[model samples]
Target: MIASPSTALVTWVLLTTPAVEQPALGTCSMGIQHLEVPPVPREKLALVCISPGQTTVINFDADLAMDSMTLDGAERFTKVEFGASTVKLIPSEKLRPGDHLRLTVRFKDTAAPSSVTLLLGVHVAQAVPFVSVLRETRTVESYQQELKTKNEELQKCIEENTRLQVESTGPGGLAELFMLGLLSDDGISSKLLHKNFVEAPTNALSATGLVSYRAANRAALMLMLANKAGMAPWTAESATLTREGKNGMGLRVLTVWQPRPIENSAEDSILVVEVKAPDDLQGSYTLKLWEAGGARTVTLHGVTFPAP
Candidate 1:
């Protein structure tokens, strides 16, 4: 007669056999597992779980040579049977938790990876009953998964390219003024300025030529400066535009462009500063420019922008 759960409870109460000590730590597999083993040898070892009195079978895709089988703790197992393409192992009670035994076997036929290795760990919770090792073989499901992954990546690339195309055709700066109908037959308004209009001390850099321009919603000033202080590789760090008696407020500076840095020893360089201008951008203003190290500065007064 087979013993039911209620009968098994009575048998457990009558029996006083010592319990087998379990391992303290192990992430044991709870069910049968399938692993695809690469043909090339890898540094990482595949794992298998084994418990006392539990039978664990390892099935391989290729036949193994019986003579090439090797197990680290072969004597500790209750029974170990090696067939043509399978290895059955029943661990004994002496195999305790935290013990990791190595099992290795070579295939009968010559292959790129001649041998397969596995780490048999004594698990405390559950043992893996079976493991199917596929060597250099992929299922149809694997190919479908790969195709799905590639499709997702291609979709992301298409979306990114569309976004770039839309931005490329959009209006950005002065170069795209024609798109906004700002560049008409009148063209951009320009005015020439002279040295008498400069207010700051011209000891480090002297402004030789000054030109101011005004468009629909933008204003710009271009200045040619002679490097009198011989500052090597001078770059304009900041520019500010402000009306007289404004004290703390200033106009919105858009951008400053310098083709190249002003080299040392009396080299003349060109600098352009652009600012945001509304219809109320009339009258005189002060424009100041400072070098990278703040050692040299340029300031101009009576700077005016003409209407578009």
Candidate 2:
């Protein structure tokens, strides 16, 4: 004998409707020809709020079974809680409000008629407000771009300043400090000026004078030095001398002072002197010399390289 058709309505209470249906089927088959369900109004809306540092709770109408309601936008469902007829969807913390989702309801009851199913559509109402992370990422990227631009500008400024400084101080500004008296003593013009034989001319030859020659200009003198031809050079700085006049030739002597020593030895000494307007004058002038206890003079002759 066929049993009477049983219809049970679940109560609307509690969070998610845990049980899928009432009156366990116990492996029974039924072809539900038709299913007529009343419209679940929007006024009967459900909401789930997930606040920071708290678990999310979703409450829905109890008319639907635990598996009846579907979450369309959820990536992964955590744990589903079910009550009498209501169902709750617990999703990852990534859920937020205003996101669209669709719900489909289905079932089978063979005792009704032929195979039939029931379906309903519900719009998403209120949802949890996830911390807006995309906005924060955009802000960070903008700040990084601005910082990069500032660093580039600073580097450019430094490079330009360095270039200007290098140009202003050229190779000619190194040394400018002396004069040299090149006196080929008698027939010993072939004499090699060794440190041992030649002293750092402190006392000019007083009894016998000597001829003197100076570098082209102060800039050029910075590169010339005394004892330069010797194996070891003399590193003296400021130097000058003048002697008695003889036969329209003014005697020229040599005087020298020391400069601050340099480890490189190249910056040690210099000869900065220039003849004013007399480049063509090759007349003999006595070199006014001052020895330890004597004195003398000689001629400083030169062929002019045509006045500049």
Candidate 3:
């Protein structure tokens, strides 16, 4: 069923389960539907993508509510054209690119995965990333300073005798933990559980965007460092394109994203920096990188590594 809550057109179908999945974490891919941007009834649904012309069959479970749902990224969808399960998209014509939609109710949800089936015509390309004007504004420059402060505090307050674990998330679904005082000063090379949760539009051409790239770099560095060739995954890595500071303390992201390779001609695509914590040190460890120069470090807090 379809309903318009935001005054923005919405379309919906009923389901009985709420199992969100992603591959790396053993979950399914997140699409316009998975994110609940389509404003469907909150229930369990197993959606199959049928592009152009394809038939789909859905089984409903129990009665579900269609009033409150999450569809924050709908603007990223140009055409959420429905397909034919037992029913097809109303308009025989394909929904065009940049087409705005208002979903009004259309499906009735029973508490269980019902025999009700639906087909949607989904499209790729020309969809803008969903960004609300009300979204928090951030200046890239100030981010590093914030990280530096957090890094210092993180290095303190938590040790083996008092080790505190802090978990955080970032763009592209980035996640990792900050462990204070867990390594020998000589063994300082930050390694831990880490993974980057990312969603690229089928319409997306590059995996390199401003925020995602920054988050990716952070994830990559944390993963690489923690792996130290092989330790554990760095689960909570993050970055800012415009962080503050001057040396390693003030790391920032470059504006130029990685583009497709052309010839071997010299092409300086801006610059990126990586921070490395000092080994065997007991102070607050921060790895900072600068585009114009090399990465630097700072001693702010203390730590307590385990015995050999």
lDDT of all predictions:
0.67, 0.26, 0.23
lDDT per residue as tens, model 1, 1-308: 11222322222221211111212223555345566778786788888988665678998888998788999989999999999999999998677656899999899988757898998988532467787777888678656755675677578557546634543675554444556444556656667665547666643677777777766665677777777553556678667677755432366565666777876655567777766676687678878776653455677887876655
Put down candidate 3 lDDT per residue, 1-308, tens digits, no spaces.
Answer: 11112101100000011111111201212112212222333354323333221222222222224442222233443333332211122221243322333332223443222222222223221111111110123335345545665666456424211311122121111112113222233322222112222321221111121111111112112111101222221221122221223321222221211122222222212111232223222222222221111111111111121112
Error of 3 at 28 (Å): 20
lDDT of 2 by residue, 1-308 (tens): 11121111001100011211112212111111111223432333222233111223322222333355455554544654544433345554343322334433332222212211211111111123211111112355445655675677578557545533543453321121111111112100111111112222332211111112222320001112222222333232222222223313221111222233222333323222222213333332222211111121111222122112
Ranking by TM-score: 1, 3, 2
Better of 1 and 3 by lDDT: 1
Best by TM-score: 1
> Candidates ranked by lDDT, best first?
1, 2, 3
| Least well predicted 10-residue stretch by lDDT in candidate 3 | 7-16
The better candidate by TM-score, 1 or 2, is 1
Stretches > 4 Å off in candidate 2: 1-63, 96-98, 103-308
Worst 10 residues of 1 by lDDT: 14-23
| lDDT value, candidate 1, whole model | 0.67
Alpha carbon deviation, residue 192, candidate 2 (Å): 86
In Å, residue 201's CA in model 3 sits off its true spot by 13
Alpha-carbon lDDT of model 2: 0.26
Q: What TM-score would every model get versus the actual structure?
A: 0.42, 0.18, 0.18
How does model 3 score by TM-score?
0.18
